[model samples]
Target: MGREAVIVGVGDLPLNGGRIVGGGSILQVQARAAKAALDDARIPMSDVDGLLVAGLWGVPGPGLLPSVTLGEYLGIHPRFADSTNIGGAAFEAHVAHAAMAIEMGYCDVALIVYGSNQKSERSRTLGGRPPILTMQFENVWGIPQPVGGYALAARRHMHEFGTTEEQLAEIAVATRGWAALNPAATMRDPITIDDVMNSTPISDPLKLLDCCLVTDGAGAIVMTTADNARAHGSTITHIRGYGEAHTHWSIGAMPDLARLTAAEMASRRAFEMAGITHDAIDLVECYDSFTITVLMTLEALGFCKPGEGGAFVSGQRTAPGGEFPMNTNGGGLSYCHPGMYGIFLLIEAVRQLRGEAGARQVQNVETALVHGTGGTLSSGATVILANN
Candidate 1:
């Protein structure tokens, strides 16, 4: 929090389609995203001393080899590089890690990148287990997929706190409204409360619409010291504060199904470090892998009381130009989800702070809060960005 890390540049490849329009495999999309980010920041690739990449889906290869491979493709021989593979939370934590590295003068500019091709090619079926044989005996029998896992948590929220399925539907309906404004959104059908309610149930309480999209896309963001922002000739969105925390990896290990302890810790630390209250935050970008996930994050982040996320997103509060204005990019719900939806959260947040979003831009978006949770609600990271 002392030495600030500001975003010098941000960019992402088209979040729709995969290996179709010149973007082949996850590696190709990652390179495209990184180049776009460097270009957006107006910084040369040679200037980047540090690189952070996320392990991607598809392109059958070594698990944690993409980061170094990407650096080679970009011709960037960085001193410090990492390929953190903490599920979707990698991108969010990458920002915090880069900020710390820059604060300590470990590197000048760090590029956080993630890309995936879950749609075009994958061995795992829609509701099938991983190709690995071990998962059959250890996991799949317990839960069909992540949707059911999150659905169990959602049902617990409803049972304990009187949360209605309609409330969960509200978040989906509102995010779709924002997606309607985004031309790049995959499913812009303009759904309604009834539409969400009537959709085929994926799990008991969670309907098909309640889940996020599984498209293929990539996103990247560049971070450096505050001085680097000025040197790059880009509008600065300084990283005033950031926080990260992690819980158990699996759902059974979670202390509470309804509450996300990692998000709670990250949100509290982020607000305290930023020296601002929740109301001071003009916008929020929360990782919404599922409707329940968004609701849990809102509650844990103090945007709304515990068990009130369903009611909190009611009446388009998250839609464009709404009072709260959460996830304006249509989010993973309607926007291009790809695999790592976390990176898009930062992209939308930075765009709003820079006033780059055309119709979706909020008025005087000076401060924004972004939270990304990885694993099965296993990890949480938060960042407070301000134009100052």
Candidate 2:
């Protein structure tokens, strides 16, 4: 139970918009991603004893028993199985859960995976979810959810902190710049603040460019005890620290729209466990469902003061060659955002830590912080990773 948790392998299907030109099932993609990760770790499929998954690949009770469904597909009979779904941040929380499970002797090796074909099939109006639970209260109002909620946060930030539309645009533009270097990013063209401002408006002060892409995507991660990783001779990214928390399911219930309270709690716990300050972080990989998400996360994660996020990201500071590197896989804004985007954030962080990201790799990265926000900024999961 005192074992250290470490990531040994990560994998992704070649981004083809999640679905092929015509047909391919989410199950196939998920299986393939799992295989890729296992192969990368040099671990046979038969070796995995734990499974964690999240997705929207079924109906009728919908995603109920996702681990059971995916376990059957991969022929993995995991002793430790978890299918906790906290929206986009689910995978990040899975890492936390898997690490705890492995350390507690509940499981030796764990695979955390996710896949979504939202772009190929589901409607963006609902972001591939039915109005269940608190959503019933939200969807009935005719408010374009998700984006509308983020827009509310953005507008509130501007009102209380004097953040500007141009500042929000800085995030989109910088992330797009990083996308230009990513071979698999869906949106590679470089964009400007004016472009973000002029792009079709979705909600007040939130333009099309400020929003994330709707695309099919799949990714997987393989984690195990440090002994197992060293036994397999796998290059490792150690799970130095991890934390997760959620505030409210509905945007209406959020105490403060301008502040991402969940992110603060999660990242604070993560940093505390890692015994490191913000300066020790080499880079960041965060959920960028909207441009506002990056700004709010930066504040919540303590990269900058709550109101200083606007200035901190100015001049494309997070873009390639900037003092800080973030969302190097282009983030959900430019990278593929298949339904839940948190899995991709973890994958990218692992890749950067391993120096395997090729063109988008951050140089000499010893440690990276990965943060994910889910729901209407309702959930947060932070993982501090290290390869040093």
Top-TM-score candidate index: 2
Return the number of clashes found in candidate 1: 0
CA RMSD (A), model 2: 1.7
Q: Which ten residues in a row have the lowest lDDT in candidate 1?
A: 14-23
**What's the lDDT for candidate 1?**
0.81
Report every candidate's CA lDDT. Answer: 0.81, 0.89
Q: Write one digit per residue (lDDT tens) for candidate 1, span 18-128.
A: 332564766777778888998999888889999998765533655447767788878888877877766676777788889889889888889988877777666324355
> Which clashing pairs does model 2 show?
none
RMSD to the true structure for each prediction, in A, is 2.3, 1.7
